[model samples]
Target: MEVAPQLRPRAGLEVVAGDVGEAVPSYAQAFQVVVNIEVKPVATVPRRTPGASEEADRLWLEHARTAAVIDDEGCFLVRGADRDWVRVRRTAHTALSAALVPGAGSMVIAMSPDGRRLCALTEEDDDYWIVVHHFEDPLM
Candidate 1:
């Protein structure tokens, strides 16, 4: 789960042009080498309706018809009720209007390595990789 400066509730960080995929690595054409760093990995984000696998998808699709970047350990944050700081992976699916719905049990954002590709960061073979893909696929 990519944590950004915006993930912080009270601190006001300037909007800067950068991406974690770009900030920390030489992206493989396959996006396999990109790292997925956890900021608050201990989070257990509350469920809006008791489902992150499906409802989470609905939330993102309804807003922008894009894939969601789910933190493996996403939970309630100190600030922004139900709000979570998600690292947007680079992808073609961009949210037209982004929203944070803690009541629904989460804070969401559409992001990318370069802010242009749909990505899923996973731990496979004991290593993290930012896998880029279309927004229509599951995190499996």
Candidate 2:
């Protein structure tokens, strides 16, 4: 995949605005696929921070729920029990509503087990970024 000129490794969290697709795999290599289920699209807003995604991965997963998989089309998908799917979808929607920028598009979303930290992969003008959102309080 061609990297967008504007997208470069930065110090803190990286942020973006818009839809993202197709490029997630390269960045999500360390994430193991937990399941594969069809997910409905939810409205998303583009927001970002400047930090190492690897760092977020470690911190987020230290207490994260099973990660939700976003497809090339930006829809959520998981391969697991019905309850797991429901939880992931619910968490995705709640996270989007609470933390995202408020726009029409799809993004990769992973929630902490406690439903507080949200890690989203978003794209804009062909450039992709990973943004992490930490809610002062839990969403549950």
- Residue 100 displacement in candidate 2 (angstroms): 17
For residues 24-123, what per-residue lDDT tens digits would candidate 1 score against the true structure? 2222322332233332221122243354434433343332223323223221111122322233322233321122323332233334323343333233
Candidate with maximal TM-score: 2
TM-score of each: 0.21, 0.29
TM-score of 1: 0.21
Model 1 Cα shift for residue 120 (angstroms): 3.8
Residue 62, candidate 1: how far off, in angstroms?
4.2
Assess candidate 1 and give its lDDT: 0.29
The weakest ten consecutive residues by lDDT in model 2 span 78-87
Best by lDDT: 2
Candidate models: Cα lDDT each:
0.29, 0.31
RMSD to the hidden true structure, all candidates: 15.5, 15.9
Which regions in candidate 1 have their CA more than 4 angstroms from the true location? 1-35, 38-49, 62-115, 119-140
